[model samples]
Each structure stands twice: as C-alpha cells, then as structure tokens.
Target: MHFRHQTLSSALAMMASLACLSPLQAQTTGAQAPVISQSDAQHLTAAPSKLTLLTLLEAAWSRQPEAQSYTERLRAAESLRAASSAWTADSPAMLLQGKTDRPGSGAGSREVEVGVALPLWLPGQSQRATALSHAQILALQGSMKAQRLQLAGLVREGWWQTQRTQTELALAQTRVANAQQIALDVARRVKAGDLARADQHQAEGAVAQAESAVAEAQGAYEASLHALRGLTGLLDLSPDNLEATSEGDVSTPLPSADALASDAPSVDEHPLFAEAMAQQSMASAQADLAASSRRASPELTVLTTRSRGQTGDPYQQSITVGLRVPFGTGARADARQAEALAAAQEAQAMTLQMRARLQAQAASALARLRSAHTQWQATHRQAQLAQESKNFFDKSFRLGETDLPTRLRIEQEAVQAQKALSRARIDVSAAWSAWWQALGELPKP
Candidate 1:
C-alpha cells in the first residue's frame, strides 16, 4: 500500500512539473532535464520504474482514438448477429374482425371473428444475414490491426531519433572534456617556454567552442525527446526503454539485408494486405446478401377463428389460411444488385492499389537502406583516417614541428569526421526501421 501511494504521488509530481513547462520550453529547456547515460542507458534520477517500449506502446494504443473507434465498431458488429431476428418476425400478430346488421328484415344479426398470425423467415435469409454481419466484424478487426501498425511505426521512428540524440550528447560532452584537457596542457607548455603564447590562446578558444557545441547538442537532444513524448503521448519514455539492436544501438554496425532475409517476414504478412483481403471479403459478402434478397420471402401465418352466428342461424366456427407475399417488379432488385456489384468492384480496385503502394514503399526503403549502409561504411573508414591524421598532427605540434593553424585544422577534421560518422550510422538504422515498417512487421502493442 505504501509503495502504491508513493508511486501515485511521484506521478502527480511529474505531471505537475510537466504542466509548468510551456510547449516552447518543452522543446528548448530553460532548466536542465534529466540526464541520460548513453553507456548504461539508466535514468539519472528517481523516476517511474520498469518502463519499457512495449509497455509504452500499449499505453499509447489504449489512448489512440482511431484504434479505439475500430475496436468499438467491431464489438457493435458482433452484437448485430443477435440483434437480427433468427426468423423474419420475432413474434406473432393478432387479427380480429366484426360485423353487424340492422333490422331491415325480421331479425337483426351480429357476428365476430378472432385469429392470430405467426411470421417466419425465408429458407436461408436469416443465416445469410448473420454471416454477413460476421464478415463485417472481421473486416473491422483488420482495420484495427492496421491502425496499430501505424502507431508502431511512429514509435520506431521516434526511438531511433532518440537514440541518435543520446549518442550526440555523449559525443559532445566527451569533446568538451578533451578540449579542456588540451587547453591545460598548452598552458603548461607555454609557461615552460615549450610552446608559443598564441598556441595557448588557440587551445582556450577551442575549449570555449567545445563548450558551445555541448550546449547546442543538449538542446537538440531535448527537442528530440520532447517530440518523442508528443508522438507517443508517453512522457516517461527514454532511451533505455527501446530494444537494443544486435550491435547495441544506432551507432553500431547493423546486419545487412541479406543477413536478415531468411528471418524476414513476407509482404503477405503485412497489415495492408490483410486489411484489403478483409474488406474484399466484406464487399463480396454484401453482394451475396443483396442477391439473396432478390428472392422474396413472405411471412407464414396460422390462425384459429371464432364466429358467433346470428339468431335462428346455425353456429359456425372455421379456420381461414392466408399467404402474404411482397411483389417486386425486379427494378428495385436489379438496382440493389448492381449497386452491390459496383461496391465489390471498388473494393477490389482499392486492394490492388494498396498492394502496389506497399510494393513501392518496400522497394524505396530497401534502396535507401542499401545506399545508407554503404555510406555508413565509407564514413567509418573516413573517421579512422581522420583519427590517425589527428594523432600525427598532435605529435608534430608537441615537438614544435607543426604550426598552430595546421594542428587546429587537423583537430577540426577529426571532430567533423566523428560527427559525420555518427550521422551516417543513424541514417542506416533509420533506413532499416523504415524497411521494417514498409513490410508491415511492426512490433505489436
């Protein structure tokens, strides 16, 4: 009980804090937000415990309006089978008639009759209607699934972006520490007359520049985090919640498409395809129902009649049978059948269109992944070369063999190379994410 109370209080506090922040400030933090450890990925403060990507996705799914709408519609559709009459008329109706004669002749007479009629269904109309409702419910289920896939896509995109931001912030902090250390070393060298005063000044300038970079990186990270929160409607989401890739993160080398091909789900497993199939079935079912409706079904009625005869006349009681059939000129039936056929045709066309769109999307994402993977490899090589060049320049500068400008240029190249490499790796990861989405293989809530 105490633990639950504590958790509630903590959540309330967090909400209060969030409420205090304006939308603008959410993106550009005026106060320091919680720091994330890119190394361990643990939250740096006391926060909601045991939050995971799956849990967050589930929470967001519950909040999604479209998903909820389809879910409700499915339930309603399911209930329709019961709402529909198993037979055409749920109950029987009563029929009564009476007649009276005035004293035009020697005797006056009065008579009355009472009867009951029971309605019935056609041969198979009741069953067909029930089946049609079930088909509609199935289509609604597929629609709900498609909506969930959309939500999952959003989560994946935001997850990768947050991963990139976390890595960038870490890199920026490391750069700042390195710059500060170099500045202190230069100061000592200048004091010992081993380096020029201008060298020390340049080192200090680099330290200041690094500090500014850290601030900028921090801002970008905060913005990305805010965007993720808005997208998922889960403010407690963090880097640790996401599934770590095989190499551990967006910065790591990911498996090639060929490596994953064997385990990859086929395009037929996609939600778009499933949804289209369901809709096509629903339209076809509707057409069947319309065609069946063309055969007119009339109610079956059973009745008992009671008659009171006039004075001096014999008492007579007899049962009268009747048939009621709805007659149509086939015009209405043709119009309805034609309308249903048109709808089925439209649904078939839409299914084809969706397949074409998915195929195009899959192809585009695959091409991007291949190109981005190659570029990431090239950037990795570039970083290695830049690191070696920076080392050579550092040694020469320390020995007074390289000018300050030359040394500064080499350091800048190394820093830019690292940044470029980070961006390329992120691109590859994002492209892979898109590929997965294109295949409609999103992780379910």
Candidate 2:
C-alpha cells in the first residue's frame, strides 16, 4: 500500500509539471499564436498578484455604456425567444344581454358564450424562434468580442508608447552625460592654457542645450506613462513593471492575394462573425414568421356559464372553440416578410464586405510591420556608424587635432542617430501591435 501511494504521488507530480509547462511550450512553438509580448515580463519589480488582463477586461465590460446597452437588448431578445416557444394563450370569456319590448307581447332573451382563441401549428414559428434565440446569443457574443478587441488595442498602444518614451529618455540622458564630460574636458584644457575661453563657452553652451533636451524628453516620457496608466487602469504601471521582448519575425513573405481572399470570410469562425451570421439567420426567421402571421394553431377550451330567465332554470354548461384569422386590407404579411428579408440580405452583404475589408486590413498591417522592421534595421546600422564617428572625433579633439565646435557637432549627431534608432525600434513594436489588432489577438500579461 505504501508503494502504491508513492507511485500515485509520483504520477501526480508528473501531471502537474506537464500542466505548467505545456502552455509555455505551446506559446513558444506557435501552437497557439498569441499577440506579441512587450518588456513587462523582464522588468516587473513586483508581481501584480491579483492583476490580470481578464480583470481589466471584465471591469471595462461592466462599465462601458455600449456593453451595458447591448446587455439590455440581449435580455429583451431572450425574452422574445422564450415567448416564441409558446405563442398562444387560452382564456374563457362571458357575455350577457337583456331586452324588453312594449305592445301586445314582450319577450327577452340572453345567452352566455365562453370561447378561447387557439393558435394553430404556425408554419415557421418553431424554426423562427430557435433561429432568433441563436441569433441573439451570437449578437451578444459579437458585442463582447468588439469591446475586448478595442480594449486590447488601446492597452497595446499605451504600452508601446510608454516603452518608446522610456527608451528616448535613456538616450536623452546619455546625451547629457556626454555633454557634461565634454564641458569638463574643455574647462581643464582652458586652465592648462591648451584651449581658449571661447572654446570653453561653446562647451558650456552645449552642456546647457543637452540638459534642456533631456528635460524635454523626460517630460514626454512622463506624459506617455500617464497615458499608459489611464488606458490600463493601473496607477502603478512603470518601466520597472514591464518586460522587454520582440515580436520575432514579421517579415515572412505573405501568401498571394488569391490565397488571402480565399480565407477572407472564413474567419467567421471568429466569435463576432459567428454572431453576425446568427443574426442574419434570425432576420430570415423573423421574415417567415411575419409572412405566416395570419396562421394559428388549433386550441381546446372548456367553459361553464350561469343564466337567469322568467320561467326556466338559470344554470348552463358549455364547451366552445374560437378561431381568428386576420384579413388585412393590404399585404401586411408580405410587407413584414419583405422587411425581414431585406435585413437578412443587408447583414449578409455587410458580412461579405467586412471580410474583404479584413483581408485588406491584414495586408496593410503586414506591410507596415515589414516597413518598420526595415527601418529599425537601417537606423540601428546608422547608430553604429554614428558611434564610430563620435569616437574618432572625440579622440581627435582631445589630441588637439580637432576643434571644440566640430567635436560638439559630432556628439550631437551621434545623439540624434541613437534617438532615431530607439524611435525605429518603437515603430517596429507599434507595427506588430497593429498586426495583432487586425488579427483579433491580444498580448498576454
């Protein structure tokens, strides 16, 4: 028994390990193609503990006015769906009448009739009801999907902006340090009678300029952080809480246009598209129901009545059947049916149009990603070249082979090149974000 228990424990441990590792492995292998990761993972000063994308999504879902409005509409649709199952109700009704006439003879007559109007087997009622219920569910699903997509895009935008600003801030700080060192060197040279007072003034001016630029960049960074906080609803979001990671490869050549179009609307497998399709089905069902408005199912009703007369017993028992068929002056049924059909047709057309648009959107996103990646590569190379130039110019200036102004210019150019490279990296990230949004994916925390 002890050995068996040990075996069971070992099996459980293995299972737990598998469970933990499987998802991470899948993420790395592209088995589940999630959105790109940002730097949040590497720089987290503290675990969010209870914070998660789900928590944020839920909060937004609850607070958003559009989501709330749609929820009410969804409830109403559900009520209608329930009503469709049992469309007819039965009740007994009573009637009384009395009359007297003057002359040679007078007579009075009264009758009570209890009847019920029963709806017959509706031609398309059952199917229509089912379709409507399904459609409503789909519509709600779509609304939720749309809300989440919007939120995800916003979060990614904020995240990328914050990262970009932080990178710029670092570049700006480096510029300040370089300028300070140059000023110090010039000051020492002037004291040693190797450099003139004019050169010292130029170095001091460059230091002040670098300081101002750093201050501006810092302000921009702070503003970006503020935006990130607002968008994510996390007051404590900072560079310390983020991890830096790349979007890997966005440069895989895309498939042909024909191939892309072929899979266009197939993404209806997506929840939103599925919901839209369901709504179209419901509209079709509604059209059928309107066309068959004049039809009803058979009904059975029982009734008991009481009556009073001059010379007879006043109690009566009876069973009655009632039937009603609407005969409108115009083609009301036809008109209603036509309206539903039109709605369904419109929904179908929109779905097709959206599919075409989605394909175009995806293509555009991919193109941007390619452009951003190329830009990043070029800018990175340029920064390297600038660094080399700055190093050469610095040594030349120190050896009295180059003037102070020329060295300062080289340093400034190097700073610009570094800033450009940082900006390009951020652009690449933003392009990946756009691609993710287009594909209906969200970055995981």
Evaluated at residue 169, the lDDT of candidate 1 is 68
Where does candidate 2 stray beyond 4 Å?
1-78, 87-121, 245-266, 270-272, 294-303, 329-334
- Backbone clash total for model 2 is 13
Error of 1 at 285 (Å): 1.0
lDDT of candidates 1 onward, in order: 0.70, 0.63
The residue pairs in collision within model 1 are none
Error of 1 at 50 (Å): 5.6
Tell me the tens digit of each residue's lDDT in model 2 across 1-445: 3553354345345434434543223222212211223554232222243544444444444545776677678787777667666655223334343333322443333345544445444567566666667676766767677667777777667667767867776666566657767877787787789999888788878877976876776677678765654454454544444555534333444334454456433466554455566666667766666666543344444444444353344545555544545444356656667788898789888777776676677788778877888888899899999999999999999899999989998998999998998788778777877776776665554
Candidate 2 TM-score to native: 0.74
In model 1, the worst 10-residue window by lDDT is 39-48
Clashes of 1: 0
